[model samples]
Target: MTLHIYNTLTREKEVFKPINPENVGMYVCGPTVYDFAHIGNARPVIVFDVLYRLLKTLYPKVTYVRNITDVDDKINAKARETGEDIRTITERTAAMFHQDMAALNAGNPDIEPRATEHIAEMIDMIERLIENGNAYEADGHVLFNVPSMPNYGALSRRNMDDMIAGARVEVASYKKDPADFVLWKPSDEDTPGWDSPWGRGRPGWHIECSAMSRKYLGDTFDIHGGGHDLVFPHHENEIAQSCCANKTDKYATYWMHNGHLMVEGEKMSKSLGNFFTVHELLEEVPGEALRFYMLSAQYRSPFDFTKEGVREAKATLDRFYTALRQHADIEADDVAAPDHFVAALKDDLNTPLAISILHELLSAFNKAPSPQTKGHLLACADILGILQQDVEGWFTQNTAADATEVDADQIMGMIEERKNAKANKDFATADKIRDDLDAMGIVLEDGPGGTTWKLK
Candidate 1:
């Protein structure tokens, strides 16, 4: 079946039709390099990465552009709070974001433009908005004229009053209307700035995406995606500025948004001690396990992340990896995934449904291990971006419970002693050795190949 995506702008699932059949363009809003990327920030990265992979299979070329906002108020505040150079802070945080995302197996976008690098493009777009009478300069700031665009809130479907009430609308006397948002603002000597038509200033948060997306993906693109939280002032303003500046009715053909993520049945907050940075979580859990847990729920549903849920995901992967290891000797044929499996993903990226199908495939493979079955299992897992690691490595890797160092040699020596005791018919010594290892949180699995041990 062809792909069907639930377009947030239309509020309906529509069959995806590419503007250019040979190539597809997609733009996703990336992170602002102020601090380590939180777990909440990872949902869209994984969600869109799935779409990117699926698109690659369907189309010949897909240009995925995810921008990095290196010059934001948060970054500025971080620099001030720590008394570090702004460049130093942004570069360091952006590097960490890349490192953390790579650990999650998220392939880098085809084009990752930084906001600071595209300052000239932002200025050019703001200039066009002003020339087109959709923006105006006031008190050294350039602000988008919300009233100029008749359908300013079309994408968000929120009225002017509701938008103002919902968003943290800045109230400045220079603004013509309360809904009017800044396109550019003057930066002081201490702040990062670039020369522009207005003054030496930095681009506003919303305009940075618009300018960067347009430069890389043209005035319009096939798909634009981000978290659902950005539907408000951020995306709405983008639609207004982009359509007005480019003189187009549509900025992007399709808009996809992943749902909000919560941690342990509540909003993730530092004060509550549930806010997790991907960096710190990597210290305890495997990144692939985190990715699998994130995909356990459908992309558009509110996700409640729990430590137990991560453990469950890891256990599930362990099962799949065990099956793969059992059939490691088979020379499998390269094959396409089952039609039903691919169909599940095409239906609005129903990852939970797709994953359930994966379990069936695993069961089928276990019941009858063959070249085609193993190949089919691997193909389906590839679409979900899992099961690519070394099977032996997966079983040997340390889980959250086994984050502390353990003496593998000592454990193996005890296992050898247990084997000798079993061979010599000393049942008491064998049981004692098993009990001692179990007390140490070591689980033993016996197969025809021999005894294997892993942390419980």
Candidate 2:
């Protein structure tokens, strides 16, 4: 079955038809590089990564662009708080974001343009908006004329009146309407700014994506994705600026958004002390386990992250690995992924259902007697990016409950003794040692490479 995406703009699930059959271009809004990315920021990263993978399989070329917002107020504040240069702060935080996202198995985008680097493009787009009468310059600031874009509230499905009330537009005297959003704002000598037609100023938050995406992927791309929070004024303003500047009716064909993440069944907030950064969570849990837990639910549904939830996801992965280890000698065919699995994923990326299909495939593989069938099972697991680690390495590196106090030499010595006991036909002693280790949450695997262990 062909892929079907639920386009937020159309308010319906439509078949995904790329502008060019040979290539697909997708753009996702990246994080503002002021602080470490939290779990909430990771949802779209993983969600879009899966889409990128799927697209690569169907199309020969896919150019995925996710921008880095480096010149925002948050970055300026972070710089002031630390008494450091803005460039230093943004560079450090952006590097940390890359490390965190890599841990979650997210592939890098084809082009990662920074906002500061694309100032010229933003300025050019703003100029076109002003020339086309969709924007005006006032008091060294450029503001988009909201009323000029008749379909301003199409994507969010909000009326202009309600949007004006909810939107946080600056109440400058130059603005003709309250709904008018800023395209460019004046920046001081200390702040980051570039020379523009109106004055020396920085581009506003919304225009960067429109300008950069157009420069990299053209005026209209296949898919534009971001968090649900950006659906309102941010994306709405993008639609206005891009369509007006380019003289087109549509900016992007499909608009995708992932739902918010919560912690312990409540909204994750700093005041509640529940906010978790990806770097902090990786200390206690494997990144694969986190990715698995995130995909356990639909992308459009709220995800509640808890300690118990992560543990459960890890346990589930252990089961799949256990079955594969039992039939390690199996050599299966390199077949394509099952049609059922593809169908589920193609339906707006229904990963929960696709994962269920994986479980079924695992069960079938466990029941198969031939070594070749087992190999095909493993191949399928590899496509999902699970069961790729050395089975022995998974247990040894991941199983330690209190890794701080454990000595590596001591654990290896125990495993050596267990091997000697089994070789000497001392079944009773070997069983006792295995049971003792199991009680400590250590699992032993006896294989051709001798005995290996992992934390339970």
Pick by lDDT: which candidate is best?
1
Error of 1 at 70 (Å): 0.3
lDDT per residue as tens, model 2, 1-456: 999999999989999999997879999999999999999999899889888887887799999999999999888888888899999888999999999898787889999999999998998899899889999988888999989999889988888778987786557788888888888999998888888888888889999999999999999989999988899989988998999999998999999999988999999999999999888888788877888899899998888999899999989988887776666666566677777887888999998998898888878877864655565556555545566677755556643335545455777788788778878999888888888777766777776756767775
Q: Judge candidate 2 at residue 276 and give its lDDT.
A: 91
* Candidate 2 error regions (>4 Å): 369-383, 398-402, 405-410, 422-441, 445-450
Residue-level lDDT tens digits of model 1 in 1-456 = 889999989899999999998989999999999899999999999999999998898899999999999989998899899999988988899899999998788989999999989988999999999899999999999999899999888888988899999887989999999989999999999989999988899999999999999998999899999999998978888999999999999999999999999999999999999999999988787789999999999999999999999989988998998888777899777999899998999999999999999999899899999999889988988888898788777766775643556688898999999999999999899999999988877888888877888776
Q: Name the best candidate (by TM-score).
A: 1
Instruction: Candidate 1: give its CA RMSD in angstroms.
Output: 1.7
Please give each candidate's TM-score.
0.96, 0.93
CA lDDT of each candidate?
A: 0.91, 0.85
> In model 1, which range of ten residues has the least summed lDDT?
396-405
Candidate 2: count the clashes: 4
